[model samples]
Target: MPRETDDHDDPTRRTYLRYGAALAGAGLFAGCAGEADPVPEQTETPRTDEPGTTTETTSSGQAREACLFPVGCREFTDPPDSVTTYNMGWADMVVALGHADRLRTNRLTAPTLFYDRFDIDYEAGYPALWQDGGFSKEVFYELDSDLFLLDPNLLEAWDDNWDESDTAEIESTVAPFFGCYNRRIRGEWQLDLGYPEQAPTMLESFDAVGTVFDERARTDAWLELHADLQARIDDRLPADPDPPSIALINGGSAPGDGEFYVLSLADDGYEMKPYRDLGLVDADGFAGIETGQYGLTDYETMLEVDPDLILVHWGITTGSVTFGGDGAFDATQFREQFVDPMASHDVGSQLTAVAEDRVLPGPTAEQGPLVNAFQTELTARLFYPDEFGVLDLDAPLDVPESEQLFDRERVRDILAGDL
Candidate 1:
């Protein structure tokens, strides 16, 4: 069952706060260029220990602490007035919590098309934390968010200039970091930087966010909805499932160049949750292809493997949003760029997946509860058109109300706090 609430007595929040306060009292706020402010002293109250009940303190006092990977234990004095995120998944969670207005900054271009369906203009005048191909320390000070929904490990891994000291400085002076880079274990850098062996599921991560933001009700509703959808799909699935073998590749990959970056269908992360839930087989494993070096493959290797289906990762995002200066994904344009080249190539057209036109757009990895719901349905239709219906590539979410896996109005109500 989904975790509806956290009832355990978490003393870590008070302990961590006291530690920071002691450091602040010592005037050791490093890297703020002598303008660093000390961590504020938090007033706490006794918390109730009851099942299905949260341990949060009064609104005027320190909040109950929540724990997750990378950033272990953290507590907020109140629901964050403003937050900063480096990924769409975290941003979407804030939006789903009806705190879209609290988003102060984002790292990537927002997936506005998906947000538009929920009547959210996520990117309107939103500041980008990344500038000129890298992150600037000054930006963190400038944003001065109440909380940072970012993984500290990622900052250290992505840029050599950022390290534990930098993260500590910001935590002491600006805000606490409360995010995990559990999308997919990119490389050894993450492990070297103390990434845990196991991480929470997408829904679990969402629940933690809810706890921090004091939005447990919204998160609970989402979990219940997700559980219902899971049950529905489970009941409908074949008892003796012979799921299709698929080759998952990045959307930016150019097949004409004979180079493709194959992603794992069996990886342990929220990014691959939908695919794993569907029981889809990984073609890369069968082909003895190594995804270690970023899963680089060529047409000759692909022809040798001949997967049953070819799935373009982040295809849905490209189709819906104009990302990274690339125009929105158009079927004709995609064909011209990917499909047509494969059909014309001497080595590409012979593949079973290409011959059968099984090349389809896959969902994005940066998904929260809201995007995950729709993506799961979209993937189901794409995988089993006979059972679910033929998905229109141009407009993926155009499924009839009766045919949709979940009710749009119900989701809208949840987001609108009408639950």
Candidate 2:
């Protein structure tokens, strides 16, 4: 749980009030049952640095503001003492900025698998925001975080009870929401749900978070390290390299089940950053699968395309975690569960990747600067073992120090505020 704030000034009251008023005027909130509820008193007098200034100060204290799509401008007094996030990418960003201790709670549980490799003992003690297969607004109120690194549109899309008013009410009474939903492209049916059509890249998003938390120094350090690793990989690849065609799928996919959710390897979201950076070809394109469809295919379909490689997404994190509902990623277990089944099946056994043992574990979609750095290197090794060195999927962190693409000790130092 997050540490409770002593100050009840509610600095964001003015902003949310304006937002709510606009929505009410547009009839967006008309006939709402909670419309009669009185707005909280404005204890903090607002201060503008300049006319039409986005930055301002509340009577309670100095406040900083930053704008990210989906959730427009957000104002907060000082860096958040405690924050809540449903997405692991945002949570990892907070951790990279040396604020893991401030994380109140999050929905994902496998971050520790990556963090622990860098000696980051990140453990969230509170219950997940998601409960009984849906998000719990009561948990949000109970946590009482200073900020929510969550996209409001995601709530509207995932929770039947959540709406624009619910978000506005929380911002007015509690803390403002600041997040962008760029994990993956939502279905076309969900387009009108307020999802941002365009969003910053993963590193760009990290920079915005740095601004919000006043941690530019740490963010800059991580960015520099990221650039160094990317350059290393770029320098090694051939100018006209023929990248392998690959099929990316959920880590939990079982070939024996004959159903698999195929992900886009060339999507614009941060989840595909590593694959894009490596210039891996999307096998879906060859298979006549449309991007963003998130379509499921069977073993026979996989045989038709015959991707050069089959990468299990979230394989590293899901497999590394010692304790989780989805058991860890052990090589023997993975082979038994996924590989052997494919080798035995008539259609699966015929696939080139299956016969050649080109199937391998891949990275998680929810990655920040820290996780991205490691995953990029891991993927590089997985894809081109002859050049970058082999990666033991079961023991991903055990890469020989000489084979490492980035400095592990340096990253640990950066996370420790030694940068």
What overall lDDT goes with each candidate model? 0.66, 0.66
Model 2 spans > 4 angstroms off: 1-62, 189-197, 284-287, 290-293, 322-329
TM per prediction: 0.82, 0.81
Report residue 16 deviation for candidate 1 (angstroms).
18
Screening candidate 2 with a backbone cut-off below 3 angstroms (N, C-alpha, C), the clashing residue pairs are: 319-329
lDDT tens readout by residue for model 2, 202-283? 6756766876887767877887888788778988877787667888776646688876767667554677788878878677
Give the clashing residue pairs of candidate 1, or none: none
| Candidate 2, residue 211: lDDT | 64
Angstrom error of the Cα, residue 194, model 2: value is 8.1
TM-score of 2: 0.81
Worst 10 residues of 2 by lDDT: 2-11
Best model number under TM-score: 1
Backbone clashes under 3 angstroms, per model: 0, 1
Q: How accurate is candidate 1 locally (lDDT)?
A: 0.66
